[model samples]
Target: MSGDDKYILVAQIGGAFGVKGEVKITAYTADAQALKAYSPLLDAKGQPALTIISARPDKHGLVAKVKELATKEEADAARGRKLYIHRDQLPEPDEDEFYLTDLVGLEGRDADDKVIGKVKSVQNFGADDMLEITPAEGGPTWYLPFTKAATPEIKPAEGWLRIIRPVETSERDAD
Candidate 1:
């Protein structure tokens, strides 16, 4: 994978917190405070962007002071900018645990080995996670519920996953 693709988005700048350069941050890490530990955050292009000078838990998320950002306007301008870190910098996940980014591009298959599509993205719209799949046959993309019953297998090394779709029930069928 390319270096840019090897980075994981860990947080986003919410907005300026105070008159100083401190900005509000919404961290995506397991521990919100751990954002300080992952210093020298990079942008999407993999260039060193923001350095966390100090960070503290806030009512909204976490307030952070960035190096060189000395005014509220400077920090406010950075709002919505995402912070990423190289995947190699992160500790590996334990067995049965996998990063969501790792799931992208894996082939979607069926129990009988039928090619469904490739995983486009994993998203959560205020509900359970959903796997967006691009049809291998060149059709519109669809989402499959990211549940054990829906996706029976996830073999990333093998470059594929087995999906067992839930049965559809109509009123007539139910009768």
Candidate 2:
């Protein structure tokens, strides 16, 4: 299949865990445990698929065993390799929610409907999500919070998001 028809990356093998061929899987899913149900994962080349034999929480990731991998050395060898699932395997998001991948390339406009830039990427730093927008004029990127106040409108079908700039107020003198 072409790259466009391939899978979306969701996880990666961290390293070997125990002597039982269990490998550490760092899941990129919002709910790490839910990743098991989204298997079997495809490799980067779109071949050598792997299924989750078992999965459980370990530190910040999930400890899992891939089907047919029966040795610690074999599991370790797959460390650092990314895991992908076919796009069709993923469920559709609920209303008002969107996947990070779906937001990339969408245009960004100000409250007045003037185009500011295009979304280069969506980032999360544990607190809140951020939108990395590349200006149309080719200046430095802008990192804006993906909050309702900052982003009031997100019309995915239109391939754009409307952002509202925060108002600055001057401090008044004491009465």
Candidate 3:
């Protein structure tokens, strides 16, 4: 296992929120406030990065005070840092539910049970999460909606997922 895999990403530090060094952050956990429970999150290199002293929900995300980031300059400098918690600190997903991080590397199979792609990573753009699958055919990676309708079966322990590939048709196709 890699050092990077030893931790699960939980949040990302945004730019400084105020002149006081309080910064805005996007929390990936089910409860943003729950981030405090896993204080002193780590950076990519597995070094202590953020020790959140206090946090409150804001219109954008959470405004937080970090133990080490005491000044706005320090906070701004840390912007875009991804925060992680030791893997053991996170709870295993309850049956049928899985963490996005856990989904990485799962094989992507089609309805026919044929290899199609590999689960690359999870991405969220303010809406529901999406899976980036690296196509088995070796072209550009594609995005699949991480919904039961699209990815009906996800067997992380089994190391694979069943995807209902979407087929798009247009009026030209009807001609």
Candidate 4:
């Protein structure tokens, strides 16, 4: 991995919230409220771009006031800007629990040790987490549930994981 890719994206400025320079931040961290705790969030260039002065939960997301921005115009200018931090800044995950950043790009192998694909994205569309995998040969992506039954092992250090194929339960398959 390149030095620039070592940083993990922690949050993103969704948009300006109010007349004040507070922006709505969609946090990607484990704890959304902890976004403030990781102050001096960096930009993709690794520069300390934003410092959270205060953050509070709003209806949509966490409303945050940066150290210098003091007006809606200032915050609006930063909309869609992603906030990042060096990987070292984050605490290591517990056993069996890996950070989403660590899981992305990992080679996914089936129970027989056959490489199925590489992890493209990890998404949570309300129900639960899903892993979008792009096949090694280049085809349309398929999704696998981020559950124990589907993903029994994750070895980020080895850059791979074991996937248990889900059983087919459709009516056609039941015939």
lDDT of each: 0.85, 0.82, 0.86, 0.84
Instruction: Indicate the worst ten consecutive residues by lDDT in candidate 4.
Output: 1-10
Decoy 1 TM-score against native:
0.89
Query: What is the per-residue lDDT of model 3 for residues 1-175, given as tens digits with 9 covering 90 to 100?
Result: 2644567888898878879989888887778887888988888888888888999986545899888888889888888988888888988778987778888999999988999999998898879999999999999998999989998888999999998877666755876
Off by over 4 Å in 2: 59-61, 165-175
> Which model, 2 or 4, shows the larger lDDT?
4
lDDT of 2 by residue, 1-175 (tens): 4667646778888878899988888988777887788877778888756688899897767998889477899888888888887777778989877777788889999877889899998888888899898998999997888888988889887899997755544433332
Q: What digit string (tens of lDDT, one per residue) describes model 1 on residues 36-72?
A: 8888888888888788888889865589888957889
lDDT of 1 at 72: 92
lDDT value for candidate 4? 0.84
Spell out the clash pairs found in candidate 1. none
Off by more than 4 A, model 1 = 1-5, 167-175
Better of 1 and 2 by lDDT: 1
Q: What is the TM-score of each candidate against the true structure?
A: 0.89, 0.78, 0.84, 0.78
Stretches of candidate 4 above 4 Å error? 1-4, 57-61, 167-175
How many residue pairs clash per model? 0, 0, 0, 0
Model 1 clash number: 0
Best by TM-score: 1
Which portions of model 3 miss their true places by more than 4 Å? 1-6, 170-175
